[model samples]
Target: MNFISFLLFSALYTCLASRLGDRTLPELSASGITTLITTPDPIKNVDPSNPASHLSKILIPRVSDTENNTIVRDYIVSTLKALQWHVEIDEFTDKTPIGTKRFRNIIATKDPTASRRVILAAHYDSKYSATYPDDQFVGATDSAAPCAMMLDVAEALNPLLDERKKRLDEGLEDDEDVADTTLQLVFFDGEEAFVVWTATDSIYGARHLADKWASTYLSPHGKRRLMGTQSTELTGIEHLILLDLLGAPQPSLRSYFLDTAWLFDALVSVERRLGESGAFAYGEEQGMAPEKWTTYFQPRTELKINMGYIGDDHVPFLERGVPVLHLIADPFPPVWHTLKDDATALDIPTMRRWNLMLRVLMSEYLHLRPEDAQPHSAVRRDASEL
Candidate 1:
């Protein structure tokens, strides 16, 4: 079978197996199936010395500090640019509890010509902790790890994106349906509050950007244009997958929104297969067992799907009728917002597992063909670069 046909068959088999229980395909090896589906180079080459390596290394204390904030902002922009993505900085000053402070949101896009977009986002700012010393509070798992994972995903998919753009530019395909879906990465600023967590103090960048995008006019291909009578709606956002508190070991992620419950289950399945393949077995660290992981739509007794809401950057987009997949641990990690939330809190095994899971998820989501996975030059960098 051709690569695309093989992928479709695999997806169909997975859905069927998921619905009818693994008993239906009793002889099928879950890990084997996942390996067959994603036939390109796996994530075994993701080394510790790579550019997208440690999350704690990219952590900054707060976005309120101009110098530090610019440092973080430039790092994100340069990283995305290195990955060959179109980068933009949404710079603005907003009124907060501690008066007006400058905030910048880093937006990066692949396949900018595609009208429909799938967003992979994370808040880059560390929370302002009055209890801890200013220099001591580095939000590693709070969001730095998640941000690093997003960048890694973008880098992994760069080959497919470049191929799609090349075909479109050379007029190899005459149909408009051949256009690929865009992947947009957003690094939100000011998700943490200066003093107290209030509506006015938190999620400043998300609120501002959501409103701005909603009011602005864009052509069908996503290029910004003059505003007409009808403004661009939030419907162009196909799915917004927001990751948070992700570096800790063995996190139990549940679906928060009912609409995107399927996506959540797919990720859970990916995690399970990865575990069965011993993908989480990194050195001495024994990650979460397969049984410990949970899915949102499992056949249970009395658990609600959309139980409660955790306020984050996706709220503004969710309020505007955008479907969201929130990948956050229900019970916050042990070192949440504490002095220990530094590099000590991060588990290398857990980060490796997440990295593999996202790579597979994005490849499946975009329906990337095996031939499209072209080998790119290594992103060489020293530890002192960032």
Candidate 2:
């Protein structure tokens, strides 16, 4: 109320804002539907290729922590350790002058010595609260599904790779044991928009990784990558498979077209291979296929990949020139950002099926070669994007 008191308060507020870094949040109302609803092909097959029984069997408790980010970072770390992979918790030490939430990423690596690397990523943090129903927002299917599935796959693959290494030492001629790339599993933080949309409120974790990987790591092709352009900054990256909202009824792979075309192509192949089609047939008959599905037209401008981009941890990597494959649902899934976005919304069987699809694609991408190992398709293909 007094002049001196007002001046002092203003000065303190200015300092806090400066320290917080003027990151603008997106307008929540700006989040809109870009895709036309259409009848999607049904899915049929459901199988777990790796049979990581124990990994799938375990119950991972992920709670919403007010102090911590919504994601259970410790749970992710523990899962990685169980697989025997060396884990690193990359800490983000910056704190706003006023108050700030802690941020970090969990990295699980298998063979650091390998020249090539594969990064499988997912954001662990969920929305702050239910934006819809009168319930707590538990992101069981949105992300917890991806995280858990990746954990199972990692656990199964790590030991398999280790065994192959042993046989090679014995001169057992293990060509199949040869891996084309080292795998890195990163659990990201700060994906949700703080104020719900502007720009700076999204993608904190991925941006950091892009800068580090592009500058510090050498590509398998041995190109001087980021060091070539914007080396002092972050400008180089080739690929990324960012899993989000993967546990819906029959989730479709909808995202920025430029970066996700290859992944999209692969998904079609996987759907056929895994027999996800039958499910879609049922969907069609059940009238679950959206009303305005279009199979041939180019995605609309608003749908112009970037135009419809739902800002998340993936954007930062995309900004750094990483070709990020955002494996997310189309139309932003109705339950998104709502209180209904909880375990009750998850379809266990559907989640299991999607998990199989992911393993199939990742294995294809990994292209592992054992001295006498076998290559098997992870999918049964009967489902598709209607």
Which predicted model would earn the best lDDT? 1
Across residues 1-386, which tens digit of lDDT does each residue of candidate 2 receive? 00011111122122212221222222111111000001011121112222332222222223223433432565556556655577887667433222465667788878655443557888776655333234445565556667766665674355446655565568774343243355778877655544544344555566666666646644334423223323322222235677777665655555464445645566555545444233222332433233422121133343344444555666556554455666677645567666666556665556544554555555555543322334322221111211
Clash pairs, model 1 backbone: none
Alpha-carbon RMSD, each predicted model: 9.4, 13.7
Residue 361 of model 1 has an lDDT of: 74
Tens-digit lDDT track of model 1 for 153-200: 776667766776777789874545335457899999888888877778
TM-score to native of every candidate shown: 0.79, 0.64
Candidate 1 stretches greater than 4 Å from native: 1-57, 130-135, 167-180, 220-233, 286-302, 380-386
Question: lDDT of all the models against the reference?
Answer: 0.66, 0.49
Instruction: Rate residue 183 of model 1 by lDDT.
Output: 87
Error at 70, model 1, angstroms: 1.2
